[model samples]
Target: MSGLPTVDDVRAARERLAPYVRRTPTYAHDAIAFKLELLQVTGSFKVRGAFNAVLQLPPEQHARGVVAVSAGNHGLAVAHVGKTLGIRATVAMPESAPARTVERMRADGAEVMLLPTVAEAFALAEERRAQGQTLIHPYDDPRVMAGQGTIGFELLEDVPDLETLVISVGGGGLIAGIATVVKALRPRVRIYGVETAGADTMRQALDAGEPVTLPAITSIATTLGAPYVSPATFDAAQRLLEDVFVVSDAQAIEGMLAAQEALSVLPEPAAACGYAAVLAGLVPRPHRGTLAILLCGGNVSIDDLVRWRSTLTV
Candidate 1:
């Protein structure tokens, strides 16, 4: 629980989470194998970590309830987990988050607190934590990272001779979790990360050799717009990833549209970032083995899509 999660932790997380979460499928589209995590319960892979974290909490802590801060998907996952486990949940989310996601969290009976920015939302959640509610960090906790690592287990089992993996990096939780497992199982497999231009938290962290906070979160991919990556995630990114690629918001939108056409499921701009990198040829074409991209979430609404599309011309 203190250090970075081990492969054993991730394996245990998979078993512990088996009954509670869905094992989302993998699909082949063109040359890229897509891990359809958007089909996960609460519309993202965050639920895996959310469930793992909450389930491991002591009974006394569960009674005290849990609080979280997220752009959207992590809040939704925590809200859904709280509802299922009969625990009171509170989420402080940025006002810029998708309206539909906010509504869904409220529908799950979680207290939804909207702040002007993600940093302010984190502040609110910390205040609530000081008041005794357990803070379920979106990306910083090892338990959550181990939970997210479950995806790596599935990917190796599903993709035949997978050579390269691409994932969108936010606070670095998803990539860290998956990379831990992938590198442990197949050390030769090349693991890569993607970020939108303005929301390049991991890319910046890797460059500076430490976590660096951005001045603003300006990307259309709000889910990938964490202002800074944590030290734990930064360590993982530095040690495990082959490279981190930065792409434009327009390219992410194009990838989202491509996913919509190919898989018939519209991915959120953040989710499409990995695919966007691949499509833009930022991730080299796999010459020997399969290249897989994670389509991580699908929590966008029509209004959200329209707003995101505007980024193209902006």
Candidate 2:
């Protein structure tokens, strides 16, 4: 499979994404170091793909507009891009989504369709396909994967000596893209995916040697709630990627706290799951080489924040 994003594709993605997205900072020090992804447009890495994907659309495609499904980041991403590019977008999201995110999407001119779950939101995206709206996959398209691959391009270009890059896996886009770039550029550099144990579709797929779908899941990392893995991406990881690890909701929350304290970035549980890997010793420790963890998303429910605050007391 063509998991490796070509150097040309990386360059093109850099050009396509340069206008709206930040070149998110790469940080290093005596201890753990990483890319400051909260600097991303819409406050997460999703913006890179959203901006590039929507902007790359032809006039006809733009006119048809775009639609996507997400409980958090992807919805905001497409909505944010639509505002910048004048493309009409609709985001179908679960009703359980944080209010702050829903309001932001609405403010950006995207029609919000609230459903009971992320699965239903995806179904709604399909429903709109009949109306000529193109699907902006949350994390499945080759273009989006290529765009996310730019993260690796930037990361490796800046920190090629990195031994292990820890990234949170949602719908497999970020890991797939980053893995492709790292593997092609420095095959020895390990790429490990950290996912919420509650929704480990990619992990399941890797174990099964094929994409697998879960029946149901309940994880605080709503943005990482991918029930099924994409065959194309799964095959890539199966062939080229390194490892997949799982983290619990409590560990994910702890990682989120570490993000707020160490990096001053309020990452969502899924975004913080990568750090949870370090906390739990999944990537091994007492090493010398650099480790780049993607800070990922900052969106969080007020309730989740309150819960995190309460935990600080006990």
Candidate 3:
């Protein structure tokens, strides 16, 4: 099967998911325009992929319901899917998952199981699978990847002359999917993948030339702290991306601060990962064409954010 995604697939996803998802906004930053994917339905880009995965499931399975494991965004994504499909949902989330995020998932009507941490959440998800629950993966699924590719399509539509597209990697769903479309449609565009310094499973995976699970994840940016990068995403990224990079949680904080200072936007740590690349000098500012970054989400607690602001170097 071809690893590339087409414009038609994105168009179909956009149409089928129109009522359920948000088209979001595209912001122009002098030289570049960003898709502002953080403005998507669930306040995260994952909603696009989650809805796509749910829609792809067999009708019976959709009716049977779905389950997922996430640090936060993916769980919220699945919760959004459940709400749209009127399906029962059980999301396994780490106990350390942000309180605001946990409440948001509940608001979306997902039955959330809070494990000790992300590791335990995965174990709980496997246990749920044995109970006949359909798993709507956050990543590592073609349907999900195709769904996220829609973001790439939107970017292309907004900035036909885009020169660079930088994305933050968790399980690599966002970048892998973006690369799938952009590399095929705009082969000249540079694809840059960013990961948190300590939680850089995807970066490590690329360096080793294969997927490798980190023994543990440690980062203040909880949402982008997936302990492992799936082989499927690694393969696609290795083949399509220009480079894989890493940044510190402090850098992610800087990214968030940059959005607030420069654009007056409130961005979550996960959504801010792309700008982390710019701060770390991993990707340069394009002087001619667009240098777009995928802002993945915006669901931070005001109190926690206030605290981050006090200590952030931005």
Predicted structure with the largest lDDT when compared to the true one: 1
**Model 2 ranges with Cα > 4 A deviation:** 1-5, 286-288, 308-314
lDDT of 3: 0.80
What are the clash counts of all predictions, listed in order?
0, 0, 0
Off by over 4 Å in 1: none
204-289: candidate 1 lDDT, tens digit per residue? 87888788999988888888978889888999988999999999999988888899999999999899988888888889787799
Q: What is the C-alpha lDDT of each candidate?
A: 0.90, 0.81, 0.80
TM-score list, all predictions = 0.96, 0.93, 0.92
At residue 164, what lDDT does model 2 achieve? Answer: 80
Residue 226 of model 2: what lDDT?
84
Model 3, C-alpha of 164: deviation from truth (Å): 1.0
* Clashing pairs for predicted structure model 2, backbone only: none
RMSD of each: 1.4, 2.3, 2.2
* TM match of model 3 to true structure: 0.92
| Deviation of model 3 at 147, angstroms | 0.7
Residue runs of model 3 more than 4 Å from their true location after superposition = 1-11, 309-314
What value does the lDDT take at residue 311 in candidate 1? 50
Best by TM-score: 1
